[model samples]
Target: MAEDRSEQEPARRPGGRTARVRHRILEAAAELIARDGIGGLRYDQVAELAEVNKTSVYRNWPDRTALVADALATFSADVAPLRDSGDIDADLVDFLEAIAAALSSRQGRALLNVVGAAHDNPDLRAVVDDAIAQRLATLSQRIKAAIETGELPAVDSHLLVEMLSGPVHLLVSRGTRELTRADAQRITSIVLAGVRATAAQHTIALAGEHDGGKTPAARP
Candidate 1:
């Protein structure tokens, strides 16, 4: 009725402005969280850092948990994503390198600290657990595929991930030294070799049982 003001206004593409605003708010939230942990994130600070209206933050995220969850989710996706390149060794080395890089960053360390203290914060615990589970699921899938292709022995994917990632986390958290590509390679090699050898022994043991416990030398 107001002289068709809608038509007079510039056509706004869907999710253009809204998406940019959401991205900015999320980035600001992550930065603040990285600098000061979860307790330090404030809407005023987020609004100021994001350069968006304070109402934008309020309208987008219902509460601190929601905002933190989204920020962590986005951070996880960007930080460390496991990829399978049909070569398990190289793939694992790359994955480990990514982990090292992430842990060395301010954002990554902040997120890890949040996770470390998650036991004290139920809301943060739930969010961190969910994000971690999602990432592990991806790693599990890649490990499963490698097993199927005979690139890896049949092993517990979760344990395998723990084995591979544990060293990186330890080295980075301790500030012992910088993680190098050689370290990633050595970790990958040692773990994979152990897994393969274990699988081989298991297979030989099963074969012995099937052959009435007769050793190869004892056979005709």
Candidate 2:
């Protein structure tokens, strides 16, 4: 029997010419942002670099923040998401490697630059906040899924996100001269160990909660 067509998952949209143009615009914005920060991006300059008219940019993005936000979003979606292979350790390593790749990219550097400039500009703050919030929300969802699947214990997903990503943000913002892949992996391993410990604590607390405040027996 044929499966109900409506019940099947919808296919993803292919990246065609329209997607290519958007990619060009994002690349241009990233370059401009890196050079002059968020304040330096002009529709005219992006249009020129993207080989399109200002009207095209305006047509796609009604405001500067929208354009910048979309660029950040597009860049982020290009990276790999954390996969659950049913092994918590391996999944964490893969997630860390993907994060390292993102941080070392040009778009990632541009994001850091915009964040720095946004600190001084009230108007830019909303734009930066929205972008960061979207990414954090995605991270939280992934963490929650891991918990539901028993791959990880129930934890404060938001706080855990901060723990995992805070180091990368600080390193990028502090103008650290040398941030290598090996260094990133080493830091991630240490952080993952801490996360595992924290998860264990949460599991113990929950067990206590369910067992009328009695502590669980120590594991061998």
Give me the candidate number with maximum lDDT: 1
Q: Which one is best on TM-score?
A: 1
Q: RMSD for all candidates, in order, please.
A: 5.4, 9.7
lDDT of 2 by residue, 1-220 (tens): 0222212224464455556666778788887886777878999999798876666677778788777777776555664576667776566556655665575566776777778878777756766676556555656777788889976666788887777778767776676554566656767678767777866777788888899988874462
Clashing pairs in 1: none
TM-score to true structure, per model = 0.81, 0.68
Kindly list the per-residue Cα lDDT of model 1 for residues 133-168, writing each as its tens digit.
Answer: 665566678888999999998899999998988898
Clashes of 1: 0
